[model samples]
Target: MAPPGCPAVAPVGKWKVIGHLQLLCLLALAQPGGPAWPCPALCQCFGNMTVFCSEEGLRNIPEEIPPSTTQLFFVETALASVPSRAFTNIAGSSHLTTLAFLGSSLEALGEAAFAGLPALRVLEISTSQLTALPGEALHGLTNLSTLSVKFSPIETLETGLFNSTPRLETLHLQGNEMESLPSDIFHPLRSLKTLTLSQNHLAELPGEVLAPLGSLQVLKLSDNNLTCLPPGFFLPLVQLQELFLDGNALMELPPGAFSRLTSLKGLHLQHNALRGLLPSVFAAQTNLTSLYLDNNRLTELPERLFHGTPSLSVLSVANNQLQALPARLFRKSPCLTLIVLSHNRLSRLPAGVFQGLPALTKLLLSHNNLTALPRDAFANLTSLEVLDLAHNQLATLPEGIFDSNIILFNVALKSNPWACDCHLAHMADWLQHTDALLNLQTLCRSPAYLKGLSLPTVKKEQLVCLPGPGSSRCRAEGLEPSGEPGTLPQCTYQDPVGAIHLACDPDACQQLSLHLPGQHFSENWTLGSGCGTVRVHITVHIEQDKAQPGGEAVLP
Candidate 1:
């Protein structure tokens, strides 16, 4: 009376034993087009060679899975221990390739746990309780190319641990408690290309630890306790393209540290205690494009330091103690697009420093003690788009300094003691026409009359350059008040209602006055009339602003 493929059952107590068969029929009907292959009672077997057994109550690997399953996910379960025969019955007859056992209570993988997974290519065991990789945990997984065991408390990786995985290309052991690596730990990983050992307590490494990995392309050793790097440490990594050495305690690097890295493209040496670098350390990295040397104590660099690296496009030497830069330091680097030299103690920049950088786009030179600039300092930056000159000792900028660059759009002129005198006429004119936005307010520092006032709102005529009362430029401008009291440079003037006389004498301060009538308005016309009075009087005008602290006056 049972279904066609269902086995017959004997009757019990004169009643047919069809209860178990009914349960099987219900599960069969849940499958698509009726179950052709036996599916696990605790898992969902998809038709595309995949099996997922992540149920909370199911503590063991399903024995009855589709034999062709290639991808198996045992996620978010309470399976405490995966014994040696855990995957034997399910993966033995199948061609399993990718297996992920994530976020489970998996504490230990018994020896030979992966014995039957010969075709396994990727295995990930993250967010689990695995503390160690047993000797034969990956016994027969010869074809495994990627193994990631992250977010676990794995402390040490013993030697010969990965002897069975010869074809492994990627290994990630980040965020672990590894303090050291055995000398021959990675000896069998001949084909490994990427190895990340970040967030560890590695203080030093043996010279020959990485000598066997000739095919490695990327290596991350950041966030460690390394205070120094051994000589010839990177001599074997000829094919490496990216090297990260940030977040360490390295104080300096020996010469020829990167001499053999000809194909390197990106080098990160930021966030270290490096105080200096030899010019020859990076002389051989010809293909390197990006270099980060920020957040260090470097005080100086060789003049021709980056001359050999013609392919470099971006470089940052910010947040250092550099006081000066040699002239034409970046002359040979034509491909440079961005340069950051902010937060340094640089007081001056030699002329023609950026002459050969034809492709330069952005230059950040803010937060320094530069008081003046050379006339042609920015003459060669034709393609510069953004220039940050804020928070410096700059009181005046050279005229026509940014004339050559027409593509410039944004410039920072804030936090500087700009003198709003005649010297700034050309710059003010340029600022008025350019499309650059003054996101910050620029204030004047000199010419007592313009102090504390925004530079952009000051008029051109108000920028009149009046030399000090004792300066030679004042005498040249016919303002030398020499003779006594009223016997000074004589002048005569007349208006429709009255005549006026003026003199550039030492004591003329009390006798000089001019007025225009407004009903009852009057200006005391007190003059001795002793010096030569005018026959054909000429009219003169002067204006006074009482709001000025000293009641300043201007004559036209």
Candidate 2:
């Protein structure tokens, strides 16, 4: 006999024992504590949920699903079509919330495939061969919050694919073959906060496509082929905090491209072909903290270009064509901490260029054409720690150039023309003593005799002093006291037209003072012979200070 609450089986001759055994098995399955019931032909069971055994061999979803099953995952399966009623029995269960169809051979999502999934909150169909999304495929998913359809061969995102997901907050459609996006594709998702469309073929963003998203916080549009941004492109996203536009072909930003993004903090515009920066490009975004403009063609920048960004901390303008910077370029950026201006054409820097940046800690000025620097160029940058001036044409530098900046830790001055001369004596002294200074091999670039010699190897003897009487004093003292054979300088006093007198002191310690006419002292007085001599017919000027007290003394 069949047990109570168990379905009954019909009788047959010689099959009665087999039928009774089957009835006992059905009775065991009907009990709450019994073993799980055996699954159908193309399915397997784990507790209440069923896993279909035909995933590899099946081309469509199974027609039947257990009543207790909630979540279904078909990962890397080969389901080419989800026919009608494929999920009919599973839709009756209201507990299903998550569904993932990753790396599938699904080329299209049929209409009403997910019609009854009202409690679904998360759905991911990434890394598939899907080329198009049909409308009404997800019509009943009202509680969906996160939907990711990335890394697919999808070329078109038809409207109403997300028509039922009204409360969605995050949508990721990145890494696709999308060349254009429909304007009203995101119209149904009013509460969306984050959208990622990176790594696409978008040439320009349509203005109205983002006009409905007022609560959006983060938008990533990087790695595209966008040449220019349209006006009011970001007008609706007032609360946006992060915007990424790197790896594009943006040559210039339109006037009001960022007029509405007042709360933006991080902006990435690097790896583009931007030739110039307009003053009003970021006029509205004042709270920016990090800005990347590297690998561009910015030849020069305006003085007040970064005036509106009060909270800016990091700025990178490296690998550009900046010939020179305005004196007041960084005057308004008091909170700036790091600045990178390396690999430019900066031949000279104006005095007090970094005077206003009181909090600046690091500065990179390498790979420039700076032949010389002013005395007090970095006088006001007291908080600077690392300064790199390597690979330049700096032949000379002023004394006490880095004296006022006591907090400096590392100073790189290598690979420069460094003209080693008396003018650089103080620099050599500072280089020897400054604990923070490095690269002492910096040598002279001019005066061919001193080339390739290290600064420390150069001494006071190797340095050539200027030509003057003081420089010839040592050589003159080395000569012999005897007169030459052809020279006639042995005479003590001689006057052809008048009487000349001579005097001598017997004591070798005696002193003598001579007076001339208008010239204070004659060149012949250096002979120290206690006599006065004159050259052939050279006229002289007599001043009262040089006149002798006694008129009887003859003067030369």
Candidate 3:
């Protein structure tokens, strides 16, 4: 029996002791220099191969790692620099394939630091203080495929950095301070498929900088300081599918800038200083599926600007200074599903602006200067689901604009000065009956009685029209003496429709021509008498209820 509160010492049989001895002998043979350090004291070793060390305040690489280790992750440490041949012991077996350092204070990488990593495929150093990559620092990484160094303050990349990494496929160098690259810097990476250089200080790219990147499928250069792109800049990127160039200072694109990107599907050019684009700039990119050109200074678009993009599904030109859109702007894109044209100065749109968009689902036209909509403005949008018209200068919309043919499910109408009068009665009725979610906080701006009142709270019956024809104001003119004095025929008659009323006695019968109110006609009836008490039958002819009395018949 063992002492209290202490580990018990079990009695070992001969077979158990023999098995323990065999295990110790196997571990000794694996090290060949007696028992090596089992694992790093500050790290947690999993399965005798993966080392996970994070936030342990480690200043340098841990020593005496097992020869069978394959992966290492050192995260959020205080290491300032990586020494040369940090993994030299493991280089013999060449088992390490991934080495990552995330959110650490590493400022510099020594020369030939990764000299022994022959089997490394992934090397990620993100959110660190790495300022420069000295030449020969990655000397012996022949099998490297993915190299990601993001959010590091790297100002310059050593020339010929990728000369040894010919097989590199994906390289992510975002959030750096690189302004200009060597003209032939990327000439060696012929097999690269994806590259991201966003949030950099690149103002211009060399004309032939991308001439050798024929296999690049994705390129992200957003949030850069690029002002303009030279001609033939993208002449060799034939296989590029996604391209991001937003947040730049591009004023205009030269013609044929994108003529070679035949396989591009998504393009982002938003948040730039672009004022216009050449009419044939995108004439060659026929396989494009999505386009974003918002937040620019463009005022008009060419009629055939999108003629080549017949397969385009989503297009956004919102937050621009556009005053009008071409009537056939989207006539070629029949598969368009989403369109965002908000925040512009568009006062009106052509009746056939949306002529060919048969698959449109979401349409955003909010924050414009539109006061009225065309009767058939949205007639072709049969598949529209979300229609946003909020924050516009619209007072009333045409009743037939959103007809029963539209299958809308969401309608945003807040912040519009809606005139709650007879003109808006149709809209009110539709809002109350339709299943669409009408976000109507639109208040009335006309009709002094309904000012400052919400459209929803106001009843439809309260909307009044002009006074009826019965309450029209009539006028009698051209009254003079028509017959003998004191013996004139009396004219006393009332229009059956109450459009006009006329009454006169003897000696008061002048040439009476009464003008009917609200009708463009005059009743001219002359009373004539030769004897006393002359009773005449008056025959009236109503020409669409608007003709005047031309002649009169007198009977004695």
Estimate the TM-score for candidate 1.
0.76
lDDT, model 2: 0.68
Candidate 3 wrong stretches, greater than 4 Å: 1-37, 66-68, 91-93, 434-438, 468-556
**What would the TM-scores of all predictions be?**
0.76, 0.67, 0.77
Candidate 3: TM-score?
0.77
Residue lDDT tens for model 1, 160-188 = 67989999999988877777888888899
lDDT of 3 at 51: 64
Scored against the true structure, residue 210 in model 1 reaches a CA lDDT of 90
- State each model's C-alpha RMSD to the native: 16.3, 20.9, 18.8
Error of 1 at 538 (Å): 15
Clashing pairs in 2: 517-542, 518-541, 518-542, 518-543
Q: Write the per-residue lDDT of candidate 2 for residues 175-248, one digit (tens) a residue.
A: 88898888888888779989999987888667788877888988999898999887778888998988999989
Q: Which residue runs of candidate 1 sit more than 4 Å off their true CA positions?
A: 1-58, 91-93, 433-438, 445-454, 457-464, 470-556
Count of clashes in candidate 1: 3
- Candidate 1, residue 342: the lDDT equals 92
After TM-score superposition, what is the CA distance of residue 532 in candidate 1 from its true location, in Å? Answer: 40
Tens-place lDDT per residue, model 3, 1-556, is: 2122212222336744443224433543453233333777677555556666665578878765666767777777788888887667642237778888877898988877887778899899988898888877787888899999989888888777888888999999999888888888787799999999999999988898888899999999999999999987888999999999999988988888889899988899999988988788788877787889999999989989999887777789999999988898998888777899999999999987987677788899999998888898888688888888889988888876788445885777778887776688887776775443365566777654466676766665445443354432232344555446676444434344432323345545322223335434444443332333222233333444544443221111
| Residue 56 lDDT, candidate 1, scale 0-100 | 86
